[model samples]
Target chain A: MRDRKESTPSRMAAVWVRCGPAALVLCAALVPLAAPSISSYIFYLMFWITMASAFNIIFGLTGYLPFGYVAFYGVGAYVTAVMWSRLGVPIPLSILSGGVLGVALSLLFAPTLRIRGIYFAIVNFSCAMALRILVANLPEAWTGGSLGISLSAIYNPNASFYTMMALMVLTIWTVGRVSGSRLGIALRCIREDPEAAQVLGVDVVRSRLKAWILAALFPSLAGGVEAWYTAIIDPDSSFNLLITTKTIVYAMFGGLGTVMGPVIGAVSLYALDDLIWGKFPMLNLLILGLLIVLLVLFLPRGIVGTVTRRHASLRAVIR
Target chain B: MRGNSVILEVKDISKHFGGLTAVNRLSFEVQEGTVFGIIGPNGSGKTTSLNCINGLFRPDEGRIFFRGREIQGLPPHQVAKIGIGRTFQVPKIFKRISVMENLLAPVLSSPRTDQELKAKAREHLHSVGMLEMEDRLGEELSGGQQKLLELVRILMFDPQILLLDEPFAGVHPTLKTLFYKKIHELRKQGKTFILVSHDLTSVYALCQQIIVLDQGEKIAQGRPEEIKRNERVIEAYLGR
Candidate 1:
């Protein structure tokens, strides 16, 4: 009797778990055939999903919330710009180089890993602000200075949209793999207690660095694609800290560590922002702020977190 | 016992926090396959010495030799990799995870498949009588159960030497007896242990050799009976 009761719900959950990813992929593939405006909105939505998942790798799994996450995105844009305009590199190769550069810049910030909690966030924020200022002041002969870079010559919205879709799939897949793998468990252990994790023979520094580098790579690629798609890149816009804030908010809204949390958070919030911003541009920020405050007060664990907390059996299926 | 090979050697190690000398020129050696005890009054640098040995803090002076390798300044994780495992003064279980996941964390570093790892974790949990609570979160366990889970978690790595800091503190009498029995069984299997505790009765019963520390200095070292009878040890504890 007990076996039958347990088996019935678990069997239903298993089917849901297996179908979730397939449904997401199918929805993403059909977006291009929807109305042209909706298709573009999805491109933006996909970009958010990619960035939020990347942020989760470090912040959710490792407990290192980097406020300077947008620095990698900015660096990716600038690197792509420099490679394409100054060095005459092709668009795709330039974007790849941008990702490599992001990894390199993250290595430079490796020392900040020793700092914990709020101080790490502060240092990372400073690093991004400093990068923005530095790029804005560089000689115009190279970085275009405050004037930014124009890549209209190679601008192709279709190519950039498809590239973003591919990147989003890869990011989600990586998060899913990490959440289920041993390394993911080790990472969560580190998040819970670094000292205990170390005693358990986890190379704390190396494990964190691996997650940080991977986190940096995705946003930089997204940045490169956005730069080419928009055909305009400015220091202020490329290194905008608002992007980092939005990514953090989305990840937190959905849930931090679970594979499905960021996706649910990004998609729902993106849709909300679109609806509010288009109708009432002046009140959009105000409404979003109020909603976030309400969410934090009522559902601090976000949607998936709240649901899983109430129904423990749903955890495996949700993830 | 005197002629046995030393598995761990602490030679004149010292650690200080600003002006406070936590451990001062402490020296000791533990023979292989023995349960060694370190006992002292509150703030006698007992925990500091354990931290220094496990690379939680580098000593201000002196050296630590683990099986003839100098590991004085190595990082805690590297020290763990070289076959030393430790439990904290306060149990440090991963509260967000299941008891089984806490045990599996260390074993993941090994090359075992998932099935083997789960089987080994269950075996350890069964030995500690915690097999039934494997699915429960670490935070949900009682203090004694958390300590038991932590002890079992370290065993997953199979370290040659174990450093247990205050393992019997606040534990129920039944759990204490179970711990004593388990320690004896591990010693029989040729495992070395360094136990730091204030429970004099348990230390006297469980340790083959003992060291007494007072105000960051070692005042005596011998069998448990000798430590109990030493004049300086008595003075250190009684404050005479």
Candidate 2:
């Protein structure tokens, strides 16, 4: 298992860069004629995948636990909603502002970024809860508060899914490049030993802060897309711990540090969600919690780790 | 000071851990091309001095100059960008990362130069005689192998002066001699080194000059032969 390197397939890695948007556009083009149920599920998975990938950047590779990821998600949703519904901003403009909000929140979280291991994890969770409560207490007239805001619906599922799919591909491609770059090496170093990385010329705190900001970008943008898709949102739904938990679990399932891990994890779990979730909706969460527990227990390295281990054992037996 | 060209200088560096001083106003100069050994008893601040120089620790007082530039208060990565390389006391080899990959890691400016980094990495691995194991994971390597790996990794930076903490620690006898031989070759080629070691014999053999730190202060600084005859060093190691 030691020598079993995951040679990241250039073809698979380039798929998003080359043809993801085209594929999404093709699928979105067909969505108008397709079944509503299938289209809704497709949009849900497509949007959430990007959010999961962003979470993977911080939580996976850097191994800094974040509980506040959904705070960014909620911010994106509400920003998009307030802009589109009240300000009459274009869909594109509102979502772009959503990305900006993500960057802002990531910056705000910089002070807390210095905390490592479990302490940092708790701070993140606390921030998410605090944001949720703050939104709940805000004047209903502004946030629509408990009632949330109902925006003009985009009837074209094609547009929503295509945009979402494009965003997802953009996220995957950007993260791949970022992780492959010097910044990624710095992050991995910080994850292993902040002190050692520092001595070796890695600015541990700065790198983590940069990662913190980038991580917030996608989840928040996904939140924007989600608000548009559902046509309305509430603080409870927008800032749900479920969003945070699901993204983290997905990344872990696929292979946290590896670039494609989130995508793989998202597809598999969402498939399971689609198959059996209707019969027992709570199963969606129960399965995630259970899978995370089992994966942590038996396969600390996750999917890629396990696959590599198997390959090594096979080689050992042959040798 | 005017007689020699100083590549790296620790200017009155001191580190306080609450009330206790770990490195106490210690200062030293590393010439552009010489092996400087720091020999002291356990808890004598050799590691702390290196950390301060590399920007891991911001000293309570003093400045560090690298290539005639102030680098004391700067963070570690910036220090790296300005070109100082280091290896840990216990090989901080990224265990999951491959041997060759470890060498390629410090090229933070460029992720892939393809042929140049690979050729250099391969050459380094070959020099350490670990080229055959270039693809092996760091954790799989033996103690001697890890030290060799770190030596090669540091070379990736092509640092003007290298800070190595206990390069000979825990290595096999034969490999220890081989490691010293490699260092001699680098010295002959005009590379500088700041080596911290408890191995006085190793220090005596390799260092042109020796700095003996005692209780966070520089107790003696001179040739290894003079340091060996110094009463304070004898008293520091074995009470007067």
Candidate 3:
């Protein structure tokens, strides 16, 4: 049966969003065409997109913007690093451990999930800064402090890149499925009005917490994968705010609640990242800042949502 | 589902915001198959008491029982699962979500299976004649349409009891008959209602029983005819 959750989506311009086995095959096929070193960057991009999608799960679905997603990202990286570097744990276990660690840390601040609008955002943002400062202050032995930690095989460019791509695609597929599910509707209700959602029998705090914990999974997973991909780990590199910032920006630029918005946004942003930073280093930040401002004002629906909405009305006329 | 009897009881529920008493020691019972009306001047703790029963606020004193079970401090959703549903004064709808999505939410989130729930939601929407607006967003609907949407969305779960804060405050003047017609139709379906409204005419028409509150106290209680002619209720409404 046609999904009645949303009416038959008007053509939506039929843009491509890669997911599931096809994504894995696509990445696998493209691996040979790109340079050996390009895989590392691909890994980075995949990890980034996945985290952005997860961020969309919470921020896009619930309207609660967490400016401190970086805290979870960094904590996951550190946890993985500790597991692998100090104890010689398997890559799989270490990454999984990172996810668990992320869940743990998420509970520490999951209370913020209850607050709405700017206050919620501020709490998350402050917590992230606090986490960053705490990580920076730690000594080298425990966490490599500012210098970070590195492992040889895990950091191999080709292998790590492939794994990251696999994870990124997995994260997207999972979130997409969830968006189409009933829990997604619950999140949207909480997003619109917590009190109303509560009255409607939506467990507001529980739903919010579930979204928050889910959002943390990808960042932690990405961190574990990143440590292996890059062969080096440090507080600065592992817990970069760029991971959080770019994901939020990407989700916003795509369409906060729509499934395809974040995926498309991440790809376009990476494209922008390459053209601007590669061409001129100093103008990079300026261009990034300007692009964000322009997008918010002119394309609040983000690229995918705007494009899809435009096509919907046009197709309606055509039909 | 609660049996056909006194399905809910509120005992001396009181909430004071610092020094300002919003709701005070109010007691009432809602029959399982009857429409219960709560009417009062503004700030008479009408909404506050409803809020307490629905678990929006923990009253500083008193208790609420649903189906002979305590529910005053239970989570709103838990209360809802126990067959309690509520609609706000201003229709609180997810503006970004489609009309079908708005209905889909309470259904999917509940333990109800998709088919039974979807059919029920569509049926409820059809009852209110809002099935066409199912594809539209909540914000895009007119005030009347929004109220209809809110009512139908609540009906999706087939709640045994309804707490409507105000189902017809800002509706178009012409739509009054239509609104009351649907309320009566739902009542025939055997759902109990705890309706809060200042529209005494509608209350008198719909309610078999009435409770009047003024300045956070239960000033009068009886059948609509008795309440209408009661000395204190007349004084509260006319201030004479």
Clashes of each: 0, 3, 5
Report the Cα lDDT for residue B26, model 3. 93
Q: What local lDDT does model 1 show for residue B178?
A: 93
TM-score of chain B of each: 0.97, 0.96, 0.94
Between prediction 1 and prediction 3, which has the larger TM-score? Answer: 1
Off by over 4 Å in 3: A1-28, A152-154, A308-319, B1-4, B109-112
- Over A181-238, each residue of candidate 2 has an lDDT whose tens digit, in order, gives 6687677777766776765666677788888888888888888887877788998899
TM-score of chain B of 2: 0.96
DockQ, candidate no. 2: 0.41
Interface RMSD of each: 4.3, 3.7, 2.0
Runs in model 1 with CA error above 4 Å? A1-10, B1-3
A1-319: candidate 3 lDDT, tens digit per residue: 1143322453432222323336555866487468865664566567768878888988888788888888777887788778888889987788889889888888898877767789988988898888888888887787876777767756566666677777777887778777767788888888888888888888888878888888888887887777776677776765566667777888888778877778778777887887778898899878877878988899997876666455543222111
Worst 10 residues of 2 chain A by lDDT: A310-319
Off by over 4 Å in 2: A1-32, A203-206, A282-287, A309-319, B1-4, B110-112
Ranked by TM-score, top first? 1, 3, 2
lDDT of 1 by residue, A1-319 (tens): 0011233555676676678767876887877778879878988999999999999999988899899899999999999999999999999999999999999999999899999799999999999999999999998988998889999999788788889988898999998888777888888899899988987788899888988898999999999988988888999999988899889889989998877889889989999999998999999878878887888898777888777766666655665
TM-score of each: 0.94, 0.89, 0.92
Docking tier of model 2: it is: acceptable
